[model samples]
Target chain A: MQFNKAMILSIGNELLIGKVLNTNAHWLSGELTKMGFIVDSIVIVKDDVSEIASAFLSAIERKVQLVISTGGLGPTFDDKTVEGLARAFSLPLVLNAEALALVREKYSSRGLPLTPERIKMAYLPLGSKPLDNPAGTAPGVYLKYRGVHFFVLPGPPREVEAVFKTSVQPIIEREFQRIDFYEALLTIKGIPESEFAPFVKDAAERYKSVYVKSHPKGVELGSPVLEIHLITFGIENMSQLRSCFEYILMSAKKLGGEIIVLKEPGVKL
Target chain B: MQFNKAMILSIGNELLIGKVLNTNAHWLSGELTKMGFIVDSIVIVKDDVSEIASAFLSAIERKVQLVISTGGLGPTFDDKTVEGLARAFSLPLVLNAEALALVREKYSSRGLPLTPERIKMAYLPLGSKPLDNPAGTAPGVYLKYRGVHFFVLPGPPREVEAVFKTSVQPIIEREFQRIDFYEALLTIKGIPESEFAPFVKDAAERYKSVYVKSHPKGVELGSPVLEIHLITFGIENMSQLRSCFEYILMSAKKLGGEIIVLKEPGVKL
Candidate 1:
C-alpha cells in the first residue's frame, strides 16, 4: 500500500487573481519530496463544484495514488469541495457524530452560539475519517475509494500544516516503506551558460544519475547571472550520492566562475 | 483574432525541489488577468526534453489560444525547452541571425568571451519571430502555428518582466480587445464560517452577477479569519462596476460582523 505518486489540487480563485500567495503548495511539495514521494503534478482550480469534480477525475485518470486537495471546506456558499467529492464518488453526505461533537465543543469553548451555519461543518462524505484540526474549526477529511486516497484539508497554511503533520504524515509513513534520498544545490552567479557547459557536461558524464540544470538569471547591474544546479537522487545509500555531489562542486570551483551560494543538507547557507 | 485563454508552462526542477521560488508564474497570471485574458492553468515541469514536449502537446490539446513557456533557453544540457518546442511543432531548429547578433552584443557589452556554447541561445524553432531581450542574452521566441501563439521567455524574473513589458505586451494588446473586471475583498474575523453563511447568501441573491467566495484564513491569533471576496465582470463600464461593488460592501457591513480590513482602488491601505 505504498503511495509512490501524488497529485495536489489547490482550490481557490484568490490564487488565480493574485489576491493571496500560494505557500501551501510549495510547503506540501517540499515536505513530500523530502519523504521520498514523487509529486506528479499540481492543479489549481476555482471553487466551482464541477471544477473540483473534474479535477478529481483527472487525478484518478493520471493514476496518482494519493490526491490531496486544499480549500473549499468551510461553511460558505463557495465551500463545496465536500459535496463535490461525495458526488464524484457517488457517496452520500451525512453528518458524522464525532465531527458534530467536535464542532459543538469548538464553538462552546469560544463562548459562541452553535448556530445553524456552524453545524454545516459537521457534514462529511460517507465513510470519511475525520482528522482533528486543533488550529481551526474545519476538520480535515480523509477518504479511501477504489485504492485511491483522497485528503481534503482546510485552506489556511497553518491549519493545513498542522493537520498534515499530525494525521496525514503518520498514515503515509505507515503505509510506505522508507527510502533513502539526498539532494544538493549549487547557486552560481555572473557566469554565462556557454562558459559553464564543459564543466557541467563532464560532471554529467561521470555520474549517471546526476542532473545539472541552468537557470538564466536576468542581468544584474551590468552582468548576467546563470544559476547552475546539480541534483542527484537514488533509493540506495546516500553516501555515494553525497560524494558525487562534492566532486561536482570541486570541479565547478576549478572552472573559475563566480560562485555566489552553495546549499546542501547538514550544511547551513 | 482575440486571445482569451492562455496557459503558462514553467520549466525548472528547482521549483519542484524548493531550491528556487516561482515568482514568474504569479506575476504572469496577474498581468494576464489584468489584460482581460483568462489563464486556464499553469504547469511546472522538469527540463527533461520529453516532459517539455508532452506538456506542450497537452497545453495545445487543452485548447488554450496562447501558450507561454519560461526557462530552458540557455546553453546547457538542461536548456532544452527551445529544442522541445521545435520538436513538438515538427520544425527544425535554426539559428536566427537577429538572435545571434543580440547574443553577441550582450556578451561584448559585458566584456565577456562569446564561446561556441553561447551560440545555442540563437537557435530557435524555424519561422519563429525573435523578441528583443535587452537585459539578457536569450532573446524571447514568438511562434504562431495551427492558430496557437507560443512565446518563449527566459527564466530570470527581471529579463522576463522587461521583455514582456517592452515587446510582448504591445503585441498581445494589439491582438485582443480588453475587457472590464473588478474584485472586492472583505476580511472578517472573530466569526466562524457557519455564522457568516446567511449573510453571504443574502448578498449573492441581491447581486446576480457578483460571485462570493470565502477563504478561511488561520493567521491571526485567537479567532480565525475569513476573507470574503466579491468578483464581478462583463460590465460595459468600469465606474458602474465600482459603484456596484460599493453597494455590496455596504450590504456586507449591515450584516453586523467584525470587518478586519477593506481595500479599494485609489484608496491606500
Candidate 2:
C-alpha cells in the first residue's frame, strides 16, 4: 500500500523571531497524520518572499502529494506568502474575483471600506481557487502545481483551524483514503535508556510494521523514566497494533520496567 | 553592519508525527535572534538519513553562517544524525577517541558495561569535535564546514539546553561580536488590524532598522486588540530602540488605540 506524503510550511516573521510559538505546525501535523498522509517535514520560514519561494520549491522538488502552508496570508506588507508562491511557479499574482468578493463581504458586513491594505488580501496566484475564511477577512488559497495540492492558510491560530477544518479537510478526505494509524505510549520507569535501547532495537527489527521510539524523560542513573511510543501505520486492525505494543511491554517487563502510564491505542491522552 | 544568518534543523520522527512539540526550535530561535543572528528558517525533518542530509545541504546552499540541529543523537538504531552529517559532506564516520572516552565515562559511572548500543554514540564525522553533554550520554558534535559553524545536539529538552549552555554558547561568544537587538511589544485595543496596517507599513518604511509587526488578538469589528511588536537590530543604544518603539506608540495613539500593555525592551514576559 502506497502512503501519500505531505509537507507543511509555517510562514511568519513572528515565528522566525521566536515571538510566536509554531503551534500551527504541530496542529496541522496531527490533522494530516490522522488523515493518513505521512507528514515528511514541517518548515518554518520568515515572511521574506525569497525564503518563502525557496521553501515552496523545495517541497515541490520533494514530490509531496499535499502541501499546507499556514501564515503570511494577511493584509499587511509582510504577508508575502501568495507572492512567494507565485514566484515559485513563475505564475502572475492576480486579484482573485472569489477572494475579492469574500474580502469585500467580510469588510462590508463590519461597515468598513475596502482600503488598499484590505484589498491586498484578495491578490492570489494565477489559476488558484479561494477557500472561504469563516473567521477572518483574508481568504485561504488552494492551488495545484506539478500534481501537488497546496492549501495556503492564514497566520492566526483560530483562522488556521477554521480554514483547515472548513475548507482544507474536505478536499483531503476526498483526495486520499485514510490509513489505519494507531499508536500507544508506555511511560515506564526503573530501566535506563541505555539498557532498554537493545530491546527497542530488537523490537523494531522484529516488528516490520511498528515503529518504536524511546524518549528519555528522566535521568539515566537516577530515577530513569522513558516514554516508549509505539506507532503503526496502515495496520490491518487495532488488534495488530495492540499485539505489537504488547510485545514491547513484555520486553520492558524483562528488564524490571514498571509501567507508570499505559495510554492504549486510540485513546486520547 | 550585516547580520549573520542562522538556520535550525529539528530532526526526529516524533516531531514530524506531531508526537512532540518542538519547543527547542522556539527557544533556539529566540537565543539566536538575541545574539544578533538572523534566523532564516527552522526545518523539522523525520529521522531519515537522506532527509537529514538534504536539509543540511539546503542550509549550506543558503549561505547561513551558523546551523544547529537537535535530536537523533542517541544509542539507538534510529539515531542517524551523525551518519547523515557524514553523508552530506562525503566524510567518513569514524569512532572519535574523545567522544568514546566521554561515552565510556558516562556509562561506567553507573556501573554499566560498554554495549554496542552504548558505544554507538561515539561515532563522529571526520574532524568534528565532541561537545561534552553535561546532562546526557551522547556527546554533542561540533564541526566547521565551508565557513558555516554547525552544532549537533541531542533530543531531550534538558540535554539540549545543558549542552547548548555549556558547549555551544561559549564558542558563539568567542567567534562573533555581539550586536544590539532590542524589541518591545505594545498591546493596544480599539484599532482593527486593517485600520492599523497602514501605520505599520509606514513605520517599517520610515524606521528602516526597526521591524514592525501587528498580531490580531481580538475581533476586528468588536473590541479589537492587537499586539504591535517593534524590533530594532544593530541600534546604537537602548535609547534609540526606545525612541523607535515610542514612535509606533504615537501612531497607535493617533488611531485612538488604548494602550493595554507595554512590554519594555530587556523585560522578560
Candidate 3:
C-alpha cells in the first residue's frame, strides 16, 4: 500500500537510555518504505504521557497520514502510551468489551488468573478498534483521529511484528491503494564514499526516480568498506525498475569494484 | 546545561537496510540525555543529497537548536553530506587548506598514496571547522548554519562517539549557557506496564517534571525480562525531580515490585 507520509513514535526508556537496542524503528521504516510509504519523521520518547502527547501533536502538525507507536502498552506503571493517546486525542481511556474478552481468553489459554493490572490491557482510547496481539498480553489499538491512523503496538518486538503483519498491514492495505515500488542495493567493496559520489550523482541524474546512497561497513572503527544503495519508485512498468537496476549495476561493475546487486520484492542478483 | 530539544540525522544506507546496527543514534541520544539535552527527533536517511537537505529543513522547522549528523564524510561516491550541507545552507563546498593538510598527513602517516578519492575528503562546507576523527580517515565537520549548530561525524559508532565527546561537547558547553538541571532514573522490575499506569499518572500529576516508562527487556522472542523506568527531570533545584522519583519508587515497592535506584548527578538518596 502507498501512504503519503508516516511517522514512528518509538515509546520506551530503554531506547532512550541505551539499555536496549531499538531494532523496531529500523525494521518498521524498512517495511513502510518497501510498502511505498514515505516515513517523514521518527520520535523516540520515554514512555511519558506529556512526551507522547507532545510527539503526537507534532506528528499531527506534520500531517502524517499514519502514526505507528511501539511500546508502552504493557501492564506496568511506565506503560503510559494509552493514556498519552487519550490525552492527545481528548478521548477518555475506556475498556472495550472485545478487547477485554480477548485479554481474558489470552490469560486463560496461558493458564494464568487475570489480575486488575492485566485487565488494564483492554483499556484503549474511546471509539478505537483493538487489533489482536496473538503473541502478547497487550492488544494493539488501531485508531483514526483527525485524518491520522494510529497503530499502538506492544513493546515486545515479536508481538509488534506479529500484530503489524496480521492486523495492521491488512487495515492499511484496505485503506490505501497498492503502488509499484522498487529498491536496488549495490554492495560495493573497497570504494570510499567520496569517490563513489560523482558516479552516483551521474546515475541519479540519468534516472529521475532513482536515488543512490553510500554506507560504510566492516570494523566499527570506520574502515572503508562501502555499500551503495540505488532505489527507484513509480516505474511506468516493471521493466523500468529492472532496467534502472541493470544500468546502475553495470556502471558500478565497470568502476572496478566488487558489486553485489539486490532487487526489491525478493530478488538478489 | 539544559536543552529542551535536539535532533540527530544519521546519514547512511546501511542503517536503513538493516545491514549495520545503528548504535550511534542510541548511544548519542543517551549521552545527550545525560548531559541534560532532550533528543526530540532522529532521522535516518540514505546518502542522497536531496534527502539530507530536506532532513535539515525538517530539523530547522522543528526549531531544534542542536543538529548532529553522522556519516557521509569519507572519500567515496556516497560521501556527499558535506556537499549536502553546503546545499542546505546555501554555502559553497570548498577545499579547506587545514582539512587538506590533515588528510595528507593522515595518509602519509599510513604510507598510503593519496588518491583522488582520498583528496576528496579535504572538501568541507565554507567556514566549517574540521573536528579530528582520532580513529578514522574522515574528520568530522562542525559548523553553524543559520543559527543552528551542526556537528557532522563519521558513521562509525566509535568514531562518532569519540568525536562527539571530544569535539562537540566542549563547543556546546561554551556556546550554550548552563541551566541548572537534574534527572533521576528508577528501574522497576516484574510489574506489568498497564497496572503501573495509575501510579505513573499520579506521579506525573503531582510532579510536573516526572516521566515514567516501561520497556520489554530482550525485545526479541524468548526474552524473559521486562523493565520499567521512572525518570524525573527538572531545571535548577533537583529536589522536585528527586521527590518524584522517591515517591514513585516507594509506591511501587509498597505494591511489591523490585525497585533499583540508579545513580544520577547530585542525588544522594
Candidate 4:
C-alpha cells in the first residue's frame, strides 16, 4: 500500500523564529520529486519534543512511505529530534556503540574531549541505524518502522546534503523502485492567466493523469504571462504527459502566445 | 486569551512538487516574527481543496491569532484556496461587488475583456473582505473565523509582499498590539558546537524568554565557526538578554575563540 509518497519535517526553533530560512525542506522536496516520490507535505515546527512527535505521528498515520526530518540532530539540549522520533514510535532511546565510536573518533581527531553534549548524539532510538555524516560530527539516523522509512539528518544544509548523497540516496536507489516521473514547463508569454484558464482546465480534465498548473508570472500590469507547468507520474503515462504538453502548446498557438521556455521532461532537480 | 502566534500555509502544487521555491513562507514568517508574533508552524500543501481546508482548520483549532496563506488566489482552475477557505468555515462562496469591480477595471484598463475565469477571483468566502491588490488583479482575502484571522494573499511573492505591505500590515498593527522582538548573532571561530552547546542550552534555560541556538557554520575539516543566535520577544527582558549575551561572550573567551561576527539585537530581519 506504499504509494511512494514522502513527507518532510524540519525541526528547529530557529526556523520557527525565522532566524533560519528552511532551504533544507525545499532542497529535499525537490530532490525527492526528482527521485519520483510524491512529497505530500513539508512542515516546519519548533524544537519541542511533543510537537515533533505529533508531527511525526501524523505523517506515520497517513501511511507515507518515507519521512525526512532535518535539524535538531546536533549536540545542544534543544536538539531533541531523536527523542521525539523515539517518543513517536514508543521506541527506547539506546546508546549505540557504533555511533559513539564515530562520535569519539570525530572529537579525538579534532583534538577535543568527548563531552556529554557531544555524546548525546550517539544515543539513537533502539533498532535504528546511523547514517554516516562525513560533513559533520552528528551521524544521521535511519529507521524503518512498519513500512515507513524515517531519516533524521543534521540541521546544517551541507551536512544534510552530504549525508543524503553518501548514505540516503544510495539506500533509496537500492530499496525504493522509482516510477516514471516527468515534468515539463511551458512558459507562455503575452497572455493573462484568466484568458488561458479554460484551456488549462480542459487539459487537466482531458489528461487525468497529469497535473496542470497555471502560475502567473510577472506581477506588473500590461504584460503578465502564465507559466503553465505539466507533471505526470508513472512510466506508463508518458502519453498523458505528451498529450497535455501538445494540448497546451496548441492552445498557446491558437491564442497567439509565444512559448518562451519549454523544459523537457527529465529530472530537473 | 489571544496570544501573538501565527501559522503559515502555502497553497500550491508548485510548492508541493518543488517546481517553485517557497520564498513566501520564509519571508512572511520572518516578518511576523519580527513583529513579535510567535510563528508556530509553516505547512505547505497542494492545491487540493480538502487538504487546504484541513490544514487551515488545524491552524484554527490550535487557536493561533492569525493564519496566513499564500498562493491559489488566481484565475486558474487549480486555484482553489478561496473555495477551501469557504469549505473550512462552512461559509457560502459569495461574489463581492468591489472585488469584481477591481478585476473588471484591471482587465478593461489593459484593453482586455474580463473572462469568466478572471471574474472567478471576485468570489470570496462569506463575510470575508477583499484586500486591494494594487500589484495584481486578484484581491487578497481576509476573514475572521470564530477567533482566528485568516489572510489569503496571491501566490506571487511580489503580490504577496505588496498586499501585505499595503493592506495586511496596517491591519495587523491596528488590531494586534506590538511587543519588542530582538535577536543577535554572535559568531565565534575555532569553537566546536560541542564546546559551546552547553552554554547555549544554559542560556536558553536561564533567560527563559530568549531562545538560544548554536548553529555550526562551515563544513570544512578546519576553521569552522559556531553562530550562537539568541532571540528574545519582550522589550522588558533586555537585561535578561544582556545576561545571556555576556555569559556566552565570557564562555567564548575562555575557549580561546575569536568573535568573527557580532550582529547586535535590533530585529535582524
Candidate 5:
C-alpha cells in the first residue's frame, strides 16, 4: 500500500503577494515526511472567507488523512480560516473554553486587558480543541472531521513550530501509523538534464518500488552539479532501502558521471 | 479599476514533498508585485497530468490575467506539464518548427544525436511560442487561451528567472497595466500582538486601498519586537501613498511603541 497522504493549506494574502516566504509549508512538509506522511499539495488562498472555506472543503473531499494549515489564526479582520472551517463543516462557531483560557492567560500574564478583538481568538468550530500556543496570543486549533485530522497553527514561523511540537505532534503519533522514512541522493556533476533524463526514466521503469527523480542544481547546460534524488516509503528493512540506493548509484557511475556526495540513507535534500 | 491580478502554479511532486523549496513562487510573486500585479494565489500540485491540467484550468476560471507555471519541463516520465496544459485548453500537442530548431541546436552543438526522448521537448501545445531558455535544454512555452497568458518554464530557479526576464517580462509589460508599487513598514518593538491587533484592523478599515498586516517577531507575549507591514497599489502619486503610510505610522507611534525599522515605501519583506 501507498503511504498516508496529507495536504497543506497556507491561508493569507501576504503569501500571494510574497510579503512572506512560506517557510512553514517547507518546514512542516519536511517534518511530516520524516514522520511518514506523504504531503500531496500545499495550497495558498486569499484572506477571503469563501476562498478559505473552499480550500478546506476541497482537501477533505480529496480524503487526505491529515490536513495541516498555517496562518489566518490571528486577531485581525482578515484572519478567517477558522470561520471558514466552521462553514465548511456546517458547524457553529463557538468559544472553546479551554482555548479561551490559554489566550486569556497569555494576555493576563502580560498585565494587558483582553480586548473584544483579542477575545475573538477563542472562537472555533464546535467539537474542536484549542491547541496550546505558548508562542503567541492566538491559540492553535485541533479538530477531526470525517476521520481527517486538521491541525491549525498560527502564522509566524516561531509560533507555528512551537505549537506544532508541543501540542500537535503527540496527537499525530497517537492517531496515525508511523513508518520509517529513507532517502538516497546522488550529486552528479557535468551533465545537462536532457542527457540525465534517460537514466532517470530507465531507473524509474526498472525499479518499480523506488522513486527516481532528478534535480538540476545549476541551470546552465554545462553545469557542474545536479541531484538525483530517490526515496522509498513503508519499507521495513533498511538493507532493502540501501540496496535500492546502491542500484541507482551504481547506474549513475556507469554514465561516466562523478558522484560528489552520497548520503547512504538519504538525508533531507 | 481593480489592480492587475496574477496567479502562480508550481507543477511538481517535489515541491509538495518539501524536497524542494518553492523559492520560485516567492521570487515570482515579489517581482510581480514590484511590477504592480496583485498576485492572488500560489498553488502547488503533483506531477500527475490531471492535477496539473486541473490547476491550470482553475486559475484561468478565477480570471487571473497572467498565470506563470514552473516545473515538469524536463525529459523524464514525470515531466508532463505541457501535455497537461494542452489538455486544459483542448489543443493538440504538436512540435512547433521553431521549438524544434532550438532543441536540435542544443543537442547538435554537443555532437549528440537527438534521441526520440530528446525530441519530445519540441512537442508543445499548438499555437504556443517557445520562450528562449538559455539556461536549460527544455525551451519554455508561452500561450494565450481565453484571454489569459500562460508562461510554462523549467523547474530550476535560474532557468525560470532567465527565461522570465528574456521572454515573459516583455509580454507582461505590453499586455497588462503596470502600476507604481509602494509599501511602508513600521517595525514596532516591545508590544504584544494582542496589543498590536486593533491598530492593524483599524488601519485596514481606514486605509481602504492599503493592506495592513502585523507579524509577531518574537514568541514571548512581552517580546521586544513586532513588525507592522502595509502595502498599496495604483496610487496616483507618492504623496498619496505617503499619506496612506503616515496614517499607520502615526497611529503606531501613538500607542507608545518604538518604531524600530521603517521601510518607507515598502521593500519585499
Candidate 6:
C-alpha cells in the first residue's frame, strides 16, 4: 500500500490568490489513479520557498511514494519551485550541463540569445535529473528523495500534459506494475441520498471488495437524484465489482428509485 | 500579516481520486481573497479521519487565522470531518440540539421520518456552533479551536455556497475589517515570457506595492503571448497601483510587445 501511495503538490502565487483553478492537481490525480496509485493528498502552497519546502517534507513524513508538483518552474522572479526543492533536501543548486544544453538548444533555434533568466532553468538540485519538456523551455525535473519519486512540472495545462506524457509517464510505468482498476457511476432518481446510504453501506460491507459512495445531486426530499459510484482494485475480483454494482442498483430500484443513467464502462465523468 | 492569513482544506475521497474538480476550494479562495485575507495554502485530503485531523493540526500549527474545510458533512459512513475535528482537539462528538432541530425541521417538512442516517448529520464537535444551510439538509459547523476559526462546510457546490453566504460570510465580516484589495491582468503578445520576465521583475521591484507574475498562453519562442497579473493591497496606495500597472504596460510596449487586452478593474482572472 505504501509503495502505491502518491501525493500532488501544486505551487504558485496565482493558485494561492485563487486566480487559477488547480486543474493540474486533478489531472495528475486521475492519471495516478488510473496507474493504480492511491492519491493520498493534493496540497497547494504559495510561491514562497519555505512553504514549498515544508509541504514537500510533510508529504515525505507521511510516507507518500510519488510526489508530483506543478508550477513555479518559469524564468520569472516569482518562480521558486526548484529552489524550494533544493531547500527541502538541503541540496546545492548546480548547473547541470545536460540541462543547460537543452535550454541553449531551445533558445538558439528561435534565434534568441541565452540570457541569465533563460540559463536559470538549467539549475537543478544535486543528484536530480532533468526531464525534457517537449512543449516548453524549462525542463521538467525528476528526483528520488527519501524513497519518494518527485516529478516537478511546468504550470500551464498544456505543458504539464506534454512533459508528463513524454517524461513522467514512462518512469511511472517502469517503476510500478499497473493494477487492475475499475470504476462505474450509476445515476438514480426518486430516492434521497440519506435513504440510499444504508443500502450503499450494506453493499460495501458485504462485498468487501467494492467501494461504494453516493452523491446527492437534486434536493434531499424533493426530486432527489443520487449518483452512486462503485470502484474496485485487483484483477481476480472483476465479477465481484459487477455484482456489487448490480446489488446497489437493485436495492435502489426496490426502494422506489429509478435508474436515470448508467455510465458506459471505461467512461469517466 | 498573520492576522489576515487563511487556509482552505477540502476533504473527500472523490476529490482525492480526481472524480471531482475541487471547485469549492477555488471558489472559497476567491471569496477569501476578495475579503483581503491572504489564503496561505489549500490542502485536499482523503475522507479518512486521521488524515483530516492531521491537516487541521498543521494549519493550526502554521498559525493560520481561519481554516475553511468543505466536504464530508453528510449521512454516509465516510463523512468523518466532524469526527476528525474532534480528534484534532481531543473533543467529544456531542449531539448538537440546535443542529438536530434544523435537520428535524427539514425532514418534517417533507413528511420524512428521522432515521439514524439523517440524524448522523446533527452531531458536531464539542463547543461547535452549527450554521444553517439554506440549500441542503446538513448544517455547516463553525468552531473556534486553538485561536483559529474553523468553518466546516458540506461537499456539494450549491450547499457550500449557500452555507458560506448565509453563515460563514457574516462571521468573517464581523471578525475582520475588509482591506482594500485590487488585481488586474495585462495580456500582451509578440514578446516571449522569458524575455518579458526581467521587465516584470523590474516593475515589481520598482513598485513595492505591486505583485506582478506572468502566465504564458502561447508558445515560448513562437508567437509568444503572456498574461501579466498584477495584484496589490491597501486603500491609500491606489495611485501607486495605477502607476505600477502603467509602468509594466509602458515597458512591454517598448519591447515590441502588443497590448492585446486589459481586464477591467475589479475583474478576477
* Winner by lDDT: 6
Alpha-carbon local distance difference test for all models: 0.74, 0.87, 0.73, 0.86, 0.82, 0.88
Query: What is the DockQ (computed on Cα atoms) for candidate 6?
Result: 0.81
What are the iRMS values of all candidates? 2.9, 1.0, 4.8, 1.7, 1.7, 0.9
Q: Which sequence of candidate numbers ranks them by lDDT, best first?
A: 6, 2, 4, 5, 1, 3
Note the B-chain TM-score for every model: 0.86, 0.96, 0.87, 0.96, 0.95, 0.96
Off by over 4 Å in 2: A235-240, A266-269, B237-240, B265-269
Model 2 lDDT tens row, B1-269:
77899999999999988878999999999988888889998999999999899888887888899999999998888999999999999899999999999999988887888998888889999999999999988999999998889999998989999999999989999998877688888898998898988888887777777778899888776778899888877756456567767777898898888996477865332
- For model 6, what is the alpha-carbon lDDT of residue B217? 91
Using Cα atoms, each model's DockQ against the true complex is 0.47, 0.74, 0.32, 0.68, 0.66, 0.81
Lowest lDDT block of 10, candidate 4 chain A: A260-269
Where model 6 places Cα greater than 4 Å from the true spot, the runs are A1-3, A264-269, B1-3, B264-269
RMSD of 2: 1.8
TM-score of chain B of 3: 0.87
lDDT digits (tens) for residues A1-269 of candidate 6:
22388999999978888789999999889988888788999999999999999988887898878899999998988899999999999999999998999999999998999999999999999999999999999999999988889999999999999999999999999987777578888888999999888888899898887778899989987888999888876666668787887788789879988896476334232
- Models ranked on TM-score: 6, 4, 2, 5, 1, 3
Report clashes for each candidate as comma-separated counts: 1, 0, 23, 0, 4, 0
Error of 3 at B6 (Å): 3.3
**Candidate 1 regions with alpha-carbon error over 4 angstroms:** A1-3, A87-90, A111-116, A188-190, A216-228, A234-237, A258-261, A264-269, B1-3, B108-116, B218-224, B234-247, B265-269
Model number 2 iRMSD = 1.0
TM agreement with the true structure for every prediction = 0.88, 0.96, 0.76, 0.97, 0.95, 0.97
Report residue A122 deviation for candidate 6 (angstroms): 0.5
Error of 3 at A15 (Å): 2.5
lDDT of 2 at B87: 94
The TM-score of predicted model 3 comes to: 0.76
Error of 4 at B213 (Å): 1.1
User: What is residue B121's positional error in candidate 5, in angstroms?
Assistant: 1.1
